[model samples]
Target chain A: MNKTGRPQDLPLSNPRADRVRDVAKLAGRPARLKRGHFLVEGPQAVREALKLHQERLAGGEPGVVTEVFASEACLDRYPEFEDLAEGTNARLATDEVLAAMADTVNPQGIIAVCRFVDVSLDTVLDAGPRLIAVLCQVRDPGNAGTVLRAADSAGADAVVLTASSVDIYNPKAVRSTAGSLFHLPVVLGADAAELAAACRARGIGILAADGYGSLNLDALQDENARRRLTGAGPASAFDLGAPTAWLFGNEAQGLSAGELDLADHRVAVPIYGAAESLNLGTAATVCLYASARSQQEPAHGETTHE
Target chain B: MNKTGRPQDLPLSNPRADRVRDVAKLAGRPARLKRGHFLVEGPQAVREALKLHQERLAGGEPGVVTEVFASEACLDRYPEFEDLAEGTNARLATDEVLAAMADTVNPQGIIAVCRFVDVSLDTVLDAGPRLIAVLCQVRDPGNAGTVLRAADSAGADAVVLTASSVDIYNPKAVRSTAGSLFHLPVVLGADAAELAAACRARGIGILAADGYGSLNLDALQDENARRRLTGAGPASAFDLGAPTAWLFGNEAQGLSAGELDLADHRVAVPIYGAAESLNLGTAATVCLYASARSQQEPAHGETTHE
Candidate 1:
């Protein structure tokens, strides 16, 4: 604002002008994503970023944020920005500049460049790992994001998007996740075969969802079958306490035959209506919830509480 | 192609153009919709309409289709038009004349007028009656469409969108459904309380998906709880075969407290990621699949027959 003939009093424009432009470009390009960084625009995502920053600061680590930008009006609207402004750099931009940098219409007037937190399979396994969703070749960013959101809300251990899936850092995907992207380890570009093998090695059951599958998920969760699927025997047998990975496929083709064959179990969502198939994201969500339900302990009995 | 100055071939400059203008106006006016009529333009939807008409014809019912409009090129592209033209009325319009009635960009050069199909709850319930998805106040047309598509793929009995939801007939919603709209019975404009009651009357356990709910879906599918929810005696205690309905709420507010209270059970998708919530459609898909899984029978031992 100082040099661009805009209001000089706005704090978000001058200091972060270059960074905002970089974020805008980064959002459209996938190669830049491998740098282990991404842009989070819109007010909701930006607010989540700031909240994460605050949490990190409170915990004694310097916030990992790269930059933040907003219109002068936004800062005034969020008065708590004063505390946020203390250790980190926050800049003001004119509404026009902010809009130009935003991916959404009616820009939320705030944006941030953030470093992707390093989340490894080891970290997720260390957590009380019960459920996880693995997206395979899901090309749509919105679908991928929505799946991540479901995984977050369902308290899955982690969400791993395979190499062929949409870029998790895509702004559309990030927006669709509704802030779940920040709360969990969203590992992208994992080798599917290796990841599947690793999950199996760790006692995780790979449940693949297919439209043509003979086994019904309902059958899997049946009392007798549940005993077999979760009964203790060999480490190779299905174990409910061990991590479970739900494999979802592309929207058009669904899971490849090879991928489906690799799973320990193939499950189908029964259809009594005329629909040809459920959308990939929806299918993934349903499968994840089903697996979660199948493994859940009886309500009246003593068990670990969520 | 017949007569240069004929009403069908002539542009709007013709003195008799009022009839054609009225036909085009019918597409936009709600009064026409209220009259149980709607227009389908472009070749895709029109082609689908024709297929639906053929299916009706095969079923020994007279098709209620009113008219078809096409340019000479369109008729020429599908020479069968000449035979189908015998019993049905076809107006040959010039490109400009056809453009006047077209609803999309780059018109597909074909249009059809047909009576709207009225589907009721009883018709859907009687179709197969296994799995169903009940949408409450989902405002996004795209989300609504995606849910319909998912329902079709998952083979749900029907999709019931509450009165507060977006219009199912919205063109955008129709397009988003990817032809599933025509294949499925999508009942819209039902009151939430009334719909819940109807589901209850049918012995369908209304499971509401909410993030803050204390019960995980895994717990709901447990043998004893499922038996209790379905009110099935101890013999089928774990048999969750009773009809079930999955309730998904608005994108922003999610299920209202009142709606959640009305549900037989409130279940949550556990989240482990940073994003806050799954999109409405994704949540619906997950919950529907969970229900489907819980009700399906296991396949392992059933294959031991001769």
Candidate 2:
């Protein structure tokens, strides 16, 4: 915005403009990889991208967003974007232009071009995270994003996607995150075996979410509760309150034998009804929240000690 | 060959036949409503539909599946389908014919036209269910289906979709259920207030899932656990272990004030991370699973009796 806090220029009316094409190309992998940038569309995601960008700029780090295109109505509806997009190259654009530049038919009249936000796995692990979610070969963009959003809601310290997983920067994936993509640290394209080893060395137990696993997730959590509340139960097979990383598998095949082998234990979210099995997102939400609740619940240490 | 249990005759090759068009029309609401039927696509869903049909027929009840269409390859791949489809009006079709009759790009070689399976709210409550999930104005078909599948996984006795909620028979919704639709009783087009009152009359407590509610789901679950383990705690705001119905709202706007007013208590699935709120399916899954676990936990009331 200019000194008056108005959009910088006349609305970009040409949908075929070189700038519009450049922005749209970020929707695909080739351009994104070449330019090291991805698209963040709609008000929620754009708002989050701008917030993170502003936060980084304030912290003396390089900003996350490079450019933002928003229609005047979007600016009017969400005035916070003005301040959030202050340091970025924010521009006024027509709906036609915005639509052309967005992967989603409805970009909610706003879009942001952002630098890839994934951090190195080492950076995430270095923070001593107590809760992490690892996705193994999850191919659906929407499923990946849903799991990430669930992870964020569960207060997971980080989210890691293995090499064969769908790109979280894929526009649908970003949209599916509902803006949680910017809320937590995400590590993409890491090797599952290496991740498991590093986590193991750090004492973060890896629990594979499998349908036919020997250990029941609810039973484990109940055991944890029994220990926390009564202090009379035998030592549980697994302490859910301890540091942990949960391994989630693909939408179809689930964790492979090799992938399951890397985990300390294979745990199944018990299906109470005949569901065959839980969807990846549902299973992940249940498992992550179980760990979150166990780790975060208030300790009645007196009962445990006696 | 008929006695030998082979696919009856030549495969359907004409994609433009009247039968094909009639079957394909089920993808739209008008067609489904007119015929009082809906499409169940994909192997898993078709298998579930066939199983339910077989079970119903065995019980001298009207079968759920009205007609079945599959490619010979699909039947060959899933041999159990032969027995499952034994009494149904099963027909073999070419891939082209199957695609023409399917809503999905790839129906995975099978689709079934099944009668609308939703029952009355009174029927559901008459079962004396221990747990139920009620969807209020949930618009997205996938979201509705995901919640239903999650509810099924949680072993919820039934699911109720209030009037104006997305039609669960929408192909996307049916596909999202991933066979869980056949596993549980569902009530659609339910009046929220009336349903709430019915549940109340049945001694079932209503809990609305709200992001800003006063009651925290985790806290309530913890209190239940403490009481279950220690047999001593203040009387909880609500007993999660009791017969209960959870109200889930729309994807974007949560429960309206009027809708929230229908519940005995409004509970927030704790947002332990920076997420603005949990997605409807995630929140529903967490809430329903919490109730499921509390209700399903083995009773150890020796401490409570004292």
- Top candidate, metric TM-score: 2
Q: Write the per-residue lDDT of candidate 1 for residues A1-306, one digit (tens) a residue.
A: 122312235354443567557656766766355566677776777777777788888999767567777776676676555555445566667677777676776557677778776477667656656687888899999888888877776667789888878888888888887777777776777777877888877877787888887765544445333344334222323443346888888877888887887788777866645665666667667666655544544333333121
lDDT of 1 at A23: 58
For model 1, state the Cα shift of residue A201 in Å: 4.5
Per-residue alpha-carbon lDDT of candidate 2 for residues B1-306, written as tens digits (9 for 90 to 100): 243334688988999999999999999999999999999999999999988998998899999998889888887788778888887788899999999999999999998999999999888888899999999999999999999999999999999999999999999999999999999999999999999889999899999999999999998988887777777776789988899999999889999999999999999999889888888888899999999998887463343323
CA lDDT of each candidate? 0.67, 0.91
Interface RMSD score of each model: 5.0, 2.0
Model 1 error, position B47 (Å): 7.8
Error of 2 at A209 (Å): 0.7
- Name the best candidate (by DockQ): 2
**Between which residue pairs do clashes occur in model 2?**
none
Question: Comparing chain B with the reference, what is the TM-score for each candidate?
Answer: 0.75, 0.96
